[model samples]
Target: MNIDVGILANARNECRKLLTEQVGVLGVVISSVDGFDVASAVTRDLEPAKIAAMASSIAAIGIVVSQEASLGASKSITVNTEDGFVYITNIELAGQLCALNVIANSSAILAQIIYHSGEIKRRLEVS
Candidate 1:
């Protein structure tokens, strides 16, 4: 997807907003469906470029697995680890599909991540 300047600005704004509003969130990234980073906000020394590429691959895998199981489209993929959680979701921005990646510490509540990411997705869609 070709990144539009307006959309990239909006994405960066939203990422920063989410980081500020959430306590345990470590980073947020907006990526092209093809695995290119568009925008990101990080509180730690995280690699958004790597995360973007991985999110794209993970999303593609999720979709393939979902279809194989006849479970319909995969909504999102959540990875829970000892230190933190990684949430990978999708958003359609300016007619192009994009990936939304959220990295949070272990203290982050799952419900909040889901809720806030959903809000971010809605905003990106209409922006």
Candidate 2:
């Protein structure tokens, strides 16, 4: 579990690729558990670092709420809207948690992205 910065960077790159190429996602971000952006594939106007920090905060709140409600371990969370869908998956590497956000049309596609991202995380963590 000797996670390095390079490993995290690779994970983020893989996440971006999965979202753009596999899931047809408009944007993707990998953020620290505390809400710092590690990597992102967003427009220039959008501050990915800020978004990552906000997402991490939201995830913290979500986790607390889930815990309070006895929702058990959170695998992933999805928010759907008329415009599109937002999916978030908690990426646990070593002892740190990173959040992956995928903006897409279909939940199935997002799930696939998250699944693949998880696999990538596992590989990076062990190797």
Candidate 3:
């Protein structure tokens, strides 16, 4: 449970890049598999702790369903609401399990989000 501050700082910086570059992004939260908020770059209205917990729950369910259905590992889960979308992706950074949760407005482009998420994953895995 003792997460390194440097790792957290890096995570936040990565998320910040995503949010700043993607105009439709509302927030980003990076959390441990156990639902602990490791780092976040979010709008003022968001509660990082709550978002992390909910995102972890969603990702866990995605993994469970994938296993039960005999599919491969769950890569990501996208939930679309009336006003926006929530995209949750499981990641491994610095050999530790983590989750990247992104909130985007209705104007967000799904393809762009998907592509950038993949790039972010690769960058995170290497760094």
Q: Largest lDDT belongs to which candidate?
A: 1
Model 3 alpha-carbon miss at residue 86, Å: 0.7
> Candidate 2, residues 1-127: lDDT per residue as tens digits?
2457787677767766765576456667877887777767864456777778778777887888899999997767777777667777787665677888766665346557667767766775675
In terms of lDDT, model 3 sits at 0.86
Model 1 sits at a Cα RMSD from the real structure of 1.1
Candidate with the larger lDDT of 2 and 3: 3
Instruction: Name the lDDT value of residue 123 in candidate 1.
Output: 89
TM-score of 2: 0.77
Question: lDDT (0-100) at residue 39 of candidate 2?
Answer: 68
Q: Rank the candidates by TM-score, best first.
A: 1, 3, 2
Locate the minimum summed-lDDT window of 10 residues in model 3. Answer: 1-10
The top-ranked prediction according to TM-score is: 1
Angstrom error at residue 25, model 3? 0.6
